[model samples]
Target: MQRNTYGQSPPLHHPVPQHVSTVPQLRSPPPPPGSAQSQQQGYAPTGQQGNPYQQQGGTSGNVFGAYGQFMNDPTAQVAAQFGQTAFKQGQEYVEQNIGRYVNVAALKHYFNVSNSYVINKLFLVLFPWRHKGWSRKQAVGANGQEGWYLSPRDDINSPDMYIPVMGLVTYVLLSTLIAGLKGAFNPELLGVTATTGLSVVIVEIIALKLGCYLLSISSQSQLFDLIAYSGYKFVGIIVTITVAEILNGGKGTGGWIGWAVFAYTFSANALFLLRSLKYVLLPETNGQPSGPMQTDSRAKRNQRTQFLFFYSYIVQLFFMWVLTRA
Candidate 1:
């Protein structure tokens, strides 16, 4: 054996043999399973053809195993049951209180109201003084039956909600139009006006209901009747705004004509309400004996009714002022 300068041993030389290829042979590892080349080459991982989840049965074998069990477990069903129970409870609560807030029968009756009745009530709500008697007779239907439905008759029997509702919507639309013409249009104004008006009406209704309860006259009137009466102010508002809009021609505030129309409508509405609400506010003074006890009771009732009626007019005035100025 011979050693080089680095002290490494050198092997003895052997005779060289000629080969066809001189390049060194190299081998590459196989491509990963599911790769494009492996898939095309028909190479697949073991158990690849079986159910992926079943292949790895144990929780430790698959990452999604716990998640799958959690989804399929009764815990989810229990949660769903709880959610459904809560929803049902909420629905029942709403159903129970729905009538307290809004009378569905009144809404249906209003929807079926006659156009002529609506027109007549429009005038009647504005000019209720012309008809001295507030007692309204049930309108006879085509079948000759006295229908208990609401009409434009001069009474507090059935309050028509249609005119008030339609009048409110009309007021908003006309107000929006006027705003646009004056170059002061705003989308938010519509919502604000509507919500404000509705809030005012609802507050008035609640106040009137409370007042009636305090006066021991709640039994004499219905909730919908108070709502109807409170809503009637919108008719006069519609007229005043419309007339003001036309007369002012979308100018700065309203001129004499606008003020004039507003004043007229205001007085008309006050008179109408005064006459129309007297029956509801006051007890039956007619067709009854007028003794000392009766007279005293009648006098007290009249005083209260007159006071409330005047307060109602003041409220109407305030609401009208807000709506028109808004």
Candidate 2:
């Protein structure tokens, strides 16, 4: 029985193979948590998740803007730039011309006449063809037909040019008429009675209106100021002519009348020439109401000068009425 017990214990043995027990299973371990490899492979991470805010690009709001502003031509912008520059330059020219030491308002008025003179003279000299065309065109009138403002001297389409020339001519003629009237009535003109000229005084009053019209047309030369000054000039010229005639009336028709008329015309012209300098220097700016500032589209013609030149035939009717009444 002792020998049988010892043999049974030695026969007991294990079932598993030696190689299979030594191998470690060779399988992948579970992903830790939120790994990039897990996401790329379409597998879930085990634990800690990723922070999306810390993405590769970081925060975004683009700092750059559009490059080219215009899609078409840029000519309009160029024109506007040049125009603004010219306007500013013109302003500077005016400031420099008047000086820092002159009565601003009075200076402005002087410039009104001066500007018109230069514009017309320049127009005539610079663009004679255009000026000729201006003269040929039928002008509109106050009577509703082709009107006359500057009759003979409308070579320029600008009113400032025509008005002053006509105004000066009218002043001279008015002086002549007054002198003629004085001779008509004054016995002293025949050398018998002693008297100052009276007919001329009345004519001077009427000439004032003509002056007013010119001033109004020229700007700052308003009819009122023009009228008064016109009357004064008439009286001065007429009185001088009349007195000369009275003193020389005894000389018969020895060309005294012609001499006096020549003197009156010349004197008026001299005054005009001097004043015209003001216009030439000051020339009208565009914003003003009158002078060259008036667009050529609106300025018709110089009716007065035309009347003196072409309508001299028509003046007889006016003279007849005035002579008979006065």
Candidate 3:
């Protein structure tokens, strides 16, 4: 080796040979089995390499393995059972107590009317001049006691809330349409119209109930019966408004033609109530007792009859007119 001027020895340079072999040398042999060096060198045993995942412990494998471990754990199984029990208990509690807040039976009865009954009821309400029988039929129980009033499907005279509910909805939609045609439409108008209609029905029902109490009219009439009867006036109001709209060529203004139709409908509604309510206000007895008691009863019955007539004609006409105007 020769030293440079900087006092650093020159690097050694090996001489090149002309005949160098091209075949590669063999790699080192793999480490023995079960040794750390074999694992580090990626030398897994033959049978062990068949399923590397099976060698994993705890939850260190794939999703299925982790899930299987969770399912097999005793604490996890107990937690799942507790959760299922809690859910079943909650469902049972709701089912048991749900009826307290709602009258499911009465609701079912009111909405049990059939389509044919609705059509006939509508016709009778509009043209009640020829309908003679007005008493609601009764269903006798196995013990021969009157169980309940016949449903509207079984008796034409039986009252139902189905027609009233549908009629109220139809009236609201139609009134909204008319308002739009008259250039008076607004988003609030629909709710206002519905509120007005409901308020009128509520007022009418209260008045009828008060009259029944004042006249000592003790019949089997339920609150829904009064509601059903009171709500029928909407049918007449609907007809009046429809006629007015037709006459005005959809201008939404009711002229004399509307008033004429209103009058006819008012009369028909009055007559209908006059006949129909007699069954409720003055129920027939098996036989009349001939004495001073009979006279007093007759007087009371007469008073009830007069009040029913006043309500049928005067009350109905006012309410019907109000609805048409609304």
- lDDT per residue for candidate 2 within 1-326, as digits (tens), equals 23465475354567967675556778686454467665544444433225333232333221221112332337756876899999999988887776675445543442254545555554443233333232222466687564323322332332242333343344445444554665654433332211122343345435534533553334443442333222223222333444555566634222656355534433443343223222322234533323553323323234333322221223222332232222
* TM-score leader: 3
Over the full model, what C-alpha lDDT does candidate 2 score relative to the true structure? 0.39
**lDDT of candidate 1 over 131-217, digit per residue (tens):** 655665665779876655344334433577777888888878888887888888999989988888888888877777777666666
lDDT of 3 by residue, 70-177 (tens): 999999999999999999999878766875875556656878888899899999999998788876677787987665677788999988888888889989999999
Candidate 1 vs 3: which has more TM-score = 3
Of the two candidates 2 and 3, the one with more favorable TM-score, higher being better, is 3
Indicate the TM-score of model 1.
0.59
Best by lDDT: 3
Give residue 14's lDDT in candidate 2 (0 to 100): 75
Error of 3 at 261 (Å): 0.6
All-Cα superposition RMSD per candidate: 13.2, 30.5, 13.9
Question: All models: lDDT?
Answer: 0.68, 0.39, 0.79
